[model samples]
Target chain A: MANQPISEPAQKFGERVRARRHELGLSQEQLADKAGLHWTFVGQVERGRRNISLHNLLKLATGLEIDPAELVRGLRRPTG
Target chain B: MANQPISEPAQKFGERVRARRHELGLSQEQLADKAGLHWTFVGQVERGRRNISLHNLLKLATGLEIDPAELVRGLRRPTG
Candidate 1:
Protein backbone atom coordinates (compact mmCIF):
# COMPACT_ATOMS: atom_id res chain seq x y z
CA MET A 1 0.00 0.00 0.00
CA ALA A 2 3.04 2.24 -0.26
CA ASN A 3 2.60 5.75 -1.60
CA GLN A 4 -0.89 5.05 -2.88
CA PRO A 5 -3.61 7.67 -2.74
CA ILE A 6 -5.95 7.12 0.20
CA SER A 7 -9.00 9.20 -0.41
CA GLU A 8 -12.15 8.56 1.59
CA PRO A 9 -13.67 6.68 -1.32
CA ALA A 10 -10.50 4.79 -2.09
CA GLN A 11 -10.18 3.71 1.51
CA LYS A 12 -13.72 2.37 1.53
CA PHE A 13 -13.02 0.58 -1.71
CA GLY A 14 -10.01 -1.08 -0.17
CA GLU A 15 -12.00 -2.08 2.89
CA ARG A 16 -14.61 -3.73 0.72
CA VAL A 17 -11.93 -5.63 -1.15
CA ARG A 18 -10.57 -7.00 2.11
CA ALA A 19 -13.98 -7.91 3.44
CA ARG A 20 -14.97 -9.64 0.24
CA ARG A 21 -11.64 -11.41 -0.02
CA HIS A 22 -12.07 -12.74 3.46
CA GLU A 23 -15.56 -13.90 2.66
CA LEU A 24 -14.25 -15.63 -0.46
CA GLY A 25 -11.32 -17.06 1.44
CA LEU A 26 -8.76 -15.86 -1.07
CA SER A 27 -5.40 -14.33 -0.32
CA GLN A 28 -4.35 -10.97 -1.72
CA GLU A 29 -1.76 -12.62 -3.95
CA GLN A 30 -4.34 -14.97 -5.38
CA LEU A 31 -6.74 -12.16 -6.08
CA ALA A 32 -4.00 -10.11 -7.73
CA ASP A 33 -3.07 -12.91 -10.14
CA LYS A 34 -6.65 -13.48 -11.13
CA ALA A 35 -7.29 -9.77 -11.55
CA GLY A 36 -4.00 -9.38 -13.50
CA LEU A 37 -2.82 -6.71 -11.08
CA HIS A 38 0.55 -6.34 -9.45
CA TRP A 39 0.60 -7.79 -5.97
CA THR A 40 1.66 -4.50 -4.51
CA PHE A 41 -1.25 -2.70 -6.12
CA VAL A 42 -3.66 -5.30 -4.89
CA GLY A 43 -2.25 -4.95 -1.43
CA GLN A 44 -2.59 -1.22 -1.61
CA VAL A 45 -6.12 -1.43 -2.91
CA GLU A 46 -7.14 -3.82 -0.19
CA ARG A 47 -5.59 -1.57 2.37
CA GLY A 48 -7.48 1.42 0.95
CA ARG A 49 -4.22 3.07 -0.12
CA ARG A 50 -4.85 3.18 -3.86
CA ASN A 51 -7.61 3.97 -6.27
CA ILE A 52 -8.32 1.37 -8.94
CA SER A 53 -9.17 1.74 -12.59
CA LEU A 54 -12.45 0.65 -14.08
CA HIS A 55 -10.68 -2.15 -15.93
CA ASN A 56 -9.05 -3.42 -12.78
CA LEU A 57 -12.34 -2.99 -10.95
CA LEU A 58 -14.01 -5.19 -13.56
CA LYS A 59 -11.22 -7.70 -13.25
CA LEU A 60 -11.64 -7.77 -9.51
CA ALA A 61 -15.38 -8.26 -9.89
CA THR A 62 -14.76 -11.10 -12.31
CA GLY A 63 -12.08 -12.61 -10.14
CA LEU A 64 -14.29 -12.37 -7.05
CA GLU A 65 -17.19 -13.85 -8.99
CA ILE A 66 -19.34 -11.00 -7.79
CA ASP A 67 -21.48 -8.44 -9.52
CA PRO A 68 -19.82 -5.15 -10.47
CA ALA A 69 -22.28 -3.41 -8.19
CA GLU A 70 -21.03 -5.42 -5.28
CA LEU A 71 -17.73 -3.60 -5.42
CA VAL A 72 -19.57 -0.33 -5.06
CA ARG A 73 -21.59 -1.44 -2.13
CA GLY A 74 -19.00 0.30 -0.06
CA LEU A 75 -19.99 3.57 -1.63
CA ARG A 76 -23.46 3.54 -0.21
CA ARG A 77 -24.48 6.40 2.07
CA PRO A 78 -23.93 5.43 5.66
CA THR A 79 -27.02 5.48 7.81
CA GLY A 80 -27.01 8.16 10.46
CA MET B 1 -10.89 19.10 -11.78
CA ALA B 2 -9.65 19.66 -8.26
CA ASN B 3 -6.70 17.75 -6.84
CA GLN B 4 -8.14 14.46 -8.02
CA PRO B 5 -6.55 11.21 -8.99
CA ILE B 6 -4.95 11.29 -12.45
CA SER B 7 -4.01 7.81 -13.47
CA GLU B 8 -4.00 6.60 -17.08
CA PRO B 9 -7.21 4.74 -16.40
CA ALA B 10 -8.93 7.74 -14.87
CA GLN B 11 -8.09 9.78 -17.99
CA LYS B 12 -9.81 7.35 -20.29
CA PHE B 13 -12.84 7.17 -18.04
CA GLY B 14 -13.14 10.95 -18.12
CA GLU B 15 -12.76 10.99 -21.86
CA ARG B 16 -15.48 8.38 -22.21
CA VAL B 17 -17.78 10.39 -20.00
CA ARG B 18 -17.19 13.50 -22.06
CA ALA B 19 -17.74 11.64 -25.31
CA ARG B 20 -20.94 10.08 -24.09
CA ARG B 21 -22.18 13.38 -22.75
CA HIS B 22 -21.51 15.01 -26.11
CA GLU B 23 -23.33 12.22 -27.85
CA LEU B 24 -26.29 12.75 -25.53
CA GLY B 25 -26.19 16.55 -25.77
CA LEU B 26 -25.86 17.04 -22.05
CA SER B 27 -23.58 19.18 -19.94
CA GLN B 28 -21.73 18.24 -16.79
CA GLU B 29 -24.09 20.28 -14.61
CA GLN B 30 -27.14 18.68 -16.21
CA LEU B 31 -25.73 15.23 -15.76
CA ALA B 32 -24.88 15.99 -12.17
CA ASP B 33 -28.42 17.03 -11.37
CA LYS B 34 -29.85 13.96 -13.04
CA ALA B 35 -27.37 11.72 -11.30
CA GLY B 36 -27.86 13.47 -7.92
CA LEU B 37 -24.18 14.25 -7.68
CA HIS B 38 -22.23 17.37 -6.93
CA TRP B 39 -21.37 19.51 -9.94
CA THR B 40 -17.74 19.52 -9.05
CA PHE B 41 -17.70 15.74 -8.79
CA VAL B 42 -19.31 15.50 -12.18
CA GLY B 43 -16.75 17.85 -13.62
CA GLN B 44 -13.98 15.94 -11.95
CA VAL B 45 -15.32 12.64 -13.24
CA GLU B 46 -15.65 13.98 -16.75
CA ARG B 47 -12.04 15.09 -16.53
CA GLY B 48 -10.84 11.70 -15.22
CA ARG B 49 -9.72 13.32 -12.01
CA ARG B 50 -11.89 11.14 -9.79
CA ASN B 51 -12.69 7.47 -9.46
CA ILE B 52 -16.42 7.02 -9.12
CA SER B 53 -18.32 4.63 -6.91
CA LEU B 54 -20.61 1.94 -8.22
CA HIS B 55 -23.68 3.76 -6.98
CA ASN B 56 -22.65 6.92 -8.80
CA LEU B 57 -21.71 4.78 -11.75
CA LEU B 58 -25.19 3.28 -11.77
CA LYS B 59 -26.69 6.71 -11.54
CA LEU B 60 -24.55 7.93 -14.40
CA ALA B 61 -25.39 4.90 -16.47
CA THR B 62 -29.04 5.44 -15.74
CA GLY B 63 -28.98 9.17 -16.35
CA LEU B 64 -27.06 8.73 -19.58
CA GLU B 65 -29.60 6.19 -20.81
CA ILE B 66 -26.95 3.56 -21.32
CA ASP B 67 -26.12 0.11 -20.08
CA PRO B 68 -23.66 -0.50 -17.26
CA ALA B 69 -21.33 -2.17 -19.70
CA GLU B 70 -21.42 0.90 -21.87
CA LEU B 71 -19.78 2.92 -19.12
CA VAL B 72 -17.10 0.28 -19.04
CA ARG B 73 -16.54 0.31 -22.77
CA GLY B 74 -13.47 2.43 -22.19
CA LEU B 75 -11.95 -0.31 -20.07
CA ARG B 76 -11.63 -2.82 -22.84
CA ARG B 77 -8.13 -3.92 -23.79
CA PRO B 78 -6.83 -1.75 -26.57
CA THR B 79 -6.04 -3.91 -29.61
CA GLY B 80 -3.27 -1.85 -31.02
Candidate 2:
Protein backbone atom coordinates (compact mmCIF):
# COMPACT_ATOMS: atom_id res chain seq x y z
CA MET A 1 0.00 0.00 0.00
CA ALA A 2 2.66 2.47 1.02
CA ASN A 3 4.97 1.32 -1.71
CA GLN A 4 2.63 1.65 -4.66
CA PRO A 5 4.81 4.08 -6.53
CA ILE A 6 7.78 1.97 -5.63
CA SER A 7 6.16 -1.02 -7.25
CA GLU A 8 5.49 0.80 -10.50
CA PRO A 9 9.03 2.02 -10.68
CA ALA A 10 10.22 -1.39 -9.65
CA GLN A 11 8.39 -3.15 -12.44
CA LYS A 12 9.35 -0.48 -14.94
CA PHE A 13 12.93 -0.99 -13.93
CA GLY A 14 12.53 -4.58 -15.03
CA GLU A 15 11.44 -3.38 -18.43
CA ARG A 16 14.55 -1.28 -18.73
CA VAL A 17 16.79 -4.16 -17.76
CA ARG A 18 15.13 -6.49 -20.22
CA ALA A 19 15.43 -3.93 -22.97
CA ARG A 20 19.07 -3.33 -22.22
CA ARG A 21 19.78 -7.01 -22.21
CA HIS A 22 18.09 -7.47 -25.53
CA GLU A 23 19.78 -4.41 -26.93
CA LEU A 24 23.12 -5.86 -25.91
CA GLY A 25 22.05 -9.17 -27.44
CA LEU A 26 22.29 -10.96 -24.13
CA SER A 27 19.88 -13.70 -23.12
CA GLN A 28 18.22 -14.09 -19.77
CA GLU A 29 20.53 -16.95 -18.94
CA GLN A 30 23.59 -14.94 -19.79
CA LEU A 31 22.45 -11.92 -17.87
CA ALA A 32 21.48 -14.06 -14.93
CA ASP A 33 24.90 -15.59 -14.80
CA LYS A 34 26.62 -12.27 -15.15
CA ALA A 35 24.45 -10.61 -12.58
CA GLY A 36 24.37 -13.53 -10.18
CA LEU A 37 20.61 -13.85 -10.23
CA HIS A 38 18.53 -16.94 -10.70
CA TRP A 39 17.59 -17.51 -14.33
CA THR A 40 13.95 -17.84 -13.36
CA PHE A 41 14.03 -14.54 -11.48
CA VAL A 42 15.41 -12.80 -14.53
CA GLY A 43 12.51 -14.01 -16.60
CA GLN A 44 10.14 -13.11 -13.80
CA VAL A 45 11.37 -9.55 -13.61
CA GLU A 46 11.28 -9.11 -17.36
CA ARG A 47 7.68 -10.20 -17.39
CA GLY A 48 6.85 -7.93 -14.44
CA ARG A 49 5.89 -10.96 -12.41
CA ARG A 50 8.51 -10.66 -9.75
CA ASN A 51 9.13 -8.14 -7.01
CA ILE A 52 12.87 -7.91 -6.87
CA SER A 53 14.80 -6.85 -3.82
CA LEU A 54 17.61 -4.32 -3.86
CA HIS A 55 20.23 -7.03 -3.80
CA ASN A 56 18.77 -8.51 -6.93
CA LEU A 57 18.65 -5.14 -8.63
CA LEU A 58 22.31 -4.67 -7.90
CA LYS A 59 22.99 -8.06 -9.36
CA LEU A 60 20.97 -7.19 -12.43
CA ALA A 61 22.91 -4.00 -12.88
CA THR A 62 26.18 -5.86 -12.50
CA GLY A 63 25.02 -8.47 -14.97
CA LEU A 64 23.94 -5.90 -17.54
CA GLU A 65 27.25 -4.15 -17.13
CA ILE A 66 25.34 -0.90 -16.80
CA ASP A 67 25.28 1.65 -14.05
CA PRO A 68 22.73 0.97 -11.33
CA ALA A 69 21.87 4.63 -11.63
CA GLU A 70 20.83 3.93 -15.19
CA LEU A 71 18.40 1.35 -13.93
CA VAL A 72 17.05 3.96 -11.54
CA ARG A 73 16.68 6.40 -14.41
CA GLY A 74 14.96 3.80 -16.51
CA LEU A 75 12.06 3.83 -14.02
CA ARG A 76 11.31 7.48 -14.73
CA ARG A 77 8.19 8.97 -16.32
CA PRO A 78 9.45 9.01 -19.85
CA THR A 79 8.46 12.18 -21.68
CA GLY A 80 6.36 11.00 -24.52
CA MET B 1 39.59 -3.09 -8.96
CA ALA B 2 37.04 -5.61 -10.03
CA ASN B 3 34.22 -3.26 -9.23
CA GLN B 4 35.88 -0.20 -10.75
CA PRO B 5 33.16 0.56 -13.23
CA ILE B 6 30.47 -0.10 -10.65
CA SER B 7 32.23 2.19 -8.23
CA GLU B 8 32.52 5.00 -10.71
CA PRO B 9 28.91 4.76 -11.65
CA ALA B 10 28.03 4.36 -8.03
CA GLN B 11 29.79 7.57 -7.08
CA LYS B 12 28.31 9.38 -10.02
CA PHE B 13 24.89 8.30 -8.84
CA GLY B 14 25.61 9.88 -5.49
CA GLU B 15 26.28 13.12 -7.28
CA ARG B 16 22.94 12.90 -9.01
CA VAL B 17 21.07 12.27 -5.76
CA ARG B 18 22.95 14.99 -3.98
CA ALA B 19 22.01 17.38 -6.73
CA ARG B 20 18.40 16.34 -6.50
CA ARG B 21 18.27 16.79 -2.74
CA HIS B 22 19.92 20.19 -2.95
CA GLU B 23 17.56 21.25 -5.70
CA LEU B 24 14.67 20.21 -3.48
CA GLY B 25 16.20 22.16 -0.62
CA LEU B 26 16.42 19.10 1.63
CA SER B 27 19.12 18.68 4.18
CA GLN B 28 20.87 15.33 4.50
CA GLU B 29 18.91 14.69 7.70
CA GLN B 30 15.58 15.34 6.03
CA LEU B 31 16.38 13.26 3.02
CA ALA B 32 17.62 10.50 5.24
CA ASP B 33 14.37 10.47 7.13
CA LYS B 34 12.37 10.27 3.93
CA ALA B 35 14.61 7.62 2.46
CA GLY B 36 14.81 5.63 5.69
CA LEU B 37 18.55 5.78 5.64
CA HIS B 38 20.87 6.74 8.43
CA TRP B 39 21.71 10.40 8.39
CA THR B 40 25.39 9.57 8.40
CA PHE B 41 25.02 7.28 5.41
CA VAL B 42 23.19 9.95 3.49
CA GLY B 43 25.99 12.34 4.22
CA GLN B 44 28.52 9.72 3.25
CA VAL B 45 26.76 9.03 -0.01
CA GLU B 46 26.46 12.68 -0.97
CA ARG B 47 30.15 13.08 -0.24
CA GLY B 48 31.00 9.88 -2.12
CA ARG B 49 32.31 8.22 1.00
CA ARG B 50 30.20 5.13 1.67
CA ASN B 51 29.24 2.63 -1.01
CA ILE B 52 25.48 2.40 -1.11
CA SER B 53 23.39 -0.62 -1.88
CA LEU B 54 20.46 -0.84 -4.28
CA HIS B 55 17.99 -0.86 -1.40
CA ASN B 56 19.19 2.57 -0.29
CA LEU B 57 18.92 3.90 -3.80
CA LEU B 58 15.27 2.90 -3.89
CA LYS B 59 14.71 4.64 -0.58
CA LEU B 60 16.42 7.74 -1.91
CA ALA B 61 14.20 7.71 -4.96
CA THR B 62 11.12 7.56 -2.78
CA GLY B 63 12.37 10.42 -0.66
CA LEU B 64 12.92 12.60 -3.71
CA GLU B 65 9.50 11.74 -5.13
CA ILE B 66 11.19 11.06 -8.46
CA ASP B 67 11.50 7.99 -10.58
CA PRO B 68 14.24 5.60 -9.67
CA ALA B 69 14.87 5.39 -13.37
CA GLU B 70 15.84 9.03 -13.27
CA LEU B 71 18.52 8.20 -10.73
CA VAL B 72 19.74 5.41 -12.92
CA ARG B 73 19.85 7.72 -15.90
CA GLY B 74 21.77 10.22 -13.86
CA LEU B 75 24.72 7.87 -14.02
CA ARG B 76 24.79 8.13 -17.78
CA ARG B 77 27.80 9.32 -19.69
CA PRO B 78 26.91 12.95 -19.93
CA THR B 79 27.03 14.01 -23.58
CA GLY B 80 29.05 17.04 -22.76
Instruction: Pick the DockQ winner.
Output: 2
Write the residue-wise lDDT of candidate 1 on A1-80 in tens digits: 55554565666777778888888898989988877777887888876775565657867876677765556642532222
Cα-based lDDT for every prediction? 0.69, 0.69
- The segments of candidate 2 whose C-alpha lies over 4 angstroms from its true place after superposition are A1-27, A32-80, B1-6, B74-80
lDDT tens per residue, model 2, B1-80: 53242355556767888999999999999999987878887877766554554456667888888877676652433221
For model 1, how does the per-residue alpha-carbon lDDT over B1-80 read when each residue is reduced to its tens digit?
45654665566777777888889999888888877778788888887777665556756766676664556643532222
The local lDDT score (0 to 100) that residue A1 gets in candidate 1 is 50
Worst 10 residues of 1 chain A by lDDT: A71-80
Error of 2 at B14 (Å): 1.1
Name the docking class for model 2: acceptable
What DockQ was computed for model 1?
A: 0.14
Per-residue lDDT of candidate 2, residues A1-80 (tens digit): 43242355556767888899998899999988887778987887876665564446667877787776677663432221
DockQ for each model:
0.14, 0.25
TM-score of each: 0.53, 0.55
